[model samples]
Target: MDRQTLDMEGARRGEISSASLQMGEDTIAVQCIATMSVESMEFSPWETATNKRAQSLYASFFVINLFFGLMALAWGGLFPGNGSSFIALVIGGVLTLLGFVLGIRAAMMARRMKRRQPYYRLVIGASDGRRIPLVDNNRDVLMRIRDVVRHKMDSGDREIRGDFDLDLDLVNLNLPTEAQKAQTLSRGPDIVPKSRQRETEVEAATAETESEVLFDQDAEIIRDAS
Candidate 1:
C-alpha cells in the first residue's frame, strides 16, 4: 500500500510517535508499528486450501473402507460353496477398522500441526550444527540478537557469528583494556627503508668487486699475449 494509506491507518491507530516523515507537499507518509506487534498475521486463502484437501482425503478414507467392507460381505454371500470367502470377509473387516483409526489420527495431527506455528528453537546445550535453544521463552534469542547488534556497533567487526562457533571469540572482548591497546601499539615494523638500502648497497659492492677481479684476470691474459 502507498505511504498515505499507511499514514492514515497509523493516524487512526494514534501511533505517529512525533516522528516526522518527510514527503513532498502532495505526498503523505505512513508510520507503521514493528511487524512483531501485529496481533494476527494475514495470509492468502490459497495457502490454506491445501489443508482442506488433506481433510477431504482423510474424510474419504472411512467411505472407501466402508465400500470395501460391503464388497467383502457381498462376496461371502455369493460363494456359499467356498469357506475362503468367509476368511476374506474377516480380513477385510480387520483392515477397514485399522484404516479408519489411522485416518482419524492423521486428520487430528494435521490440524494440530497447522494450528501450531512452527518455531525454530536453538538449544544451547544440545547444539549439534542445528538449533541453539535460548531461554525457554525466546528471551535468550532476543538477548543474543541485542548483544550481537551491540557488539557490531561497538567493535565495527563484520565477521559472521557462525565463524565463532568453535570459539567464543566475540564474547571475550569485554572491554579492550587500556593495557592491551598499549601492548598492541608497542609492536613496531621490522624492515625500515634505511636498513633495506644498506643491504642493497652491500650486495652491489660485492658484485663490483667480483667484476674487478675478472677484469684483472683478463688484463693478465692480454699482457701474456702481447
Candidate 2:
C-alpha cells in the first residue's frame, strides 16, 4: 500500500504511530475529551494527587465565588437610597472585585490550557481521538497552532478537512514563513535610535505573520521557571 493508505489504515486499526515529529506553538484549556474509562483513570500514576487537589480547589472556588457574586448583584439591586446605596455599593464592589479576579484567572487558565494541550487529539476515523501530545519542549509549537486556529477557532475548524479538524485546532501549529520583504513607510527618517522599540515592533509583526514565533527555543516567555 501507498504511504497515505498505510497511515489511514493504521490510524483506523489503532496501530498508527507518529509519522513525523511536530512542535506545538500554542494551547487552550479545552474540555479535553478522550476515551479513557473511570475504571482506567483510577490506575494512572500521572494523574497526581496535587493536580487533582488543585483542580478541585479551583472548581470549588469558581462555583462559590460565582454564586456569591450573582446573589449580591441580584439582592443588592432590590434596594434604593443612600443607606441602601451603601449596601448596594458594597455588593457591587464585591462582585466587581470577584469579576476582576475571575478575569485574571481566566487569562491564567488560558495560558495554562495552552501549555497543557501542547499538541492535539488525533482522530483518524474517530475511535475517539487520543491526546497526541507534542514531543518538543520548545515554545514555538503553540505559536503555530494559534495562527492556524485564529480563523475558525470556535468550531475548532470542524468544517476544514474533517480528518485534520482536531489536528488543526490542536494549538501550537507553527505556520510557514513568508519570503516577501517587509516594506512600511514611517512618518519620517531615522531620528532617535529606538533600537529596542524597533526590535519589539519587528517581533510583534513577525508574531502576526504565519510563523509568528520571534523568540528562539531558549528565549523565555514564562519567567519564574524553577
Residue-level lDDT of model 2, residues 64-117, one tens digit each, is 776777666666666554466567657766865776576566555444433322
Q: Global lDDT for candidate 1?
A: 0.44
Estimate candidate 2's RMSD in Å: 32.0
TM-score of each: 0.32, 0.26
* Per-residue alpha-carbon lDDT of candidate 1 for residues 1-226, written as tens digits (9 for 90 to 100): 0011112211111111122111112111112211111122222222244556666676677677767776776777788589788886786787578667757865774655455222222222211232222211223433453354344545554442321111121222223455567877797555569989999999999999999999999999999999
TM accuracy, model 1 = 0.32
TM-score of 2: 0.26
The total number of steric clashes, by the backbone 3 Å criterion, in model 2 comes to: 18
Score residue 214 of candidate 1 by CA lDDT.
Answer: 100
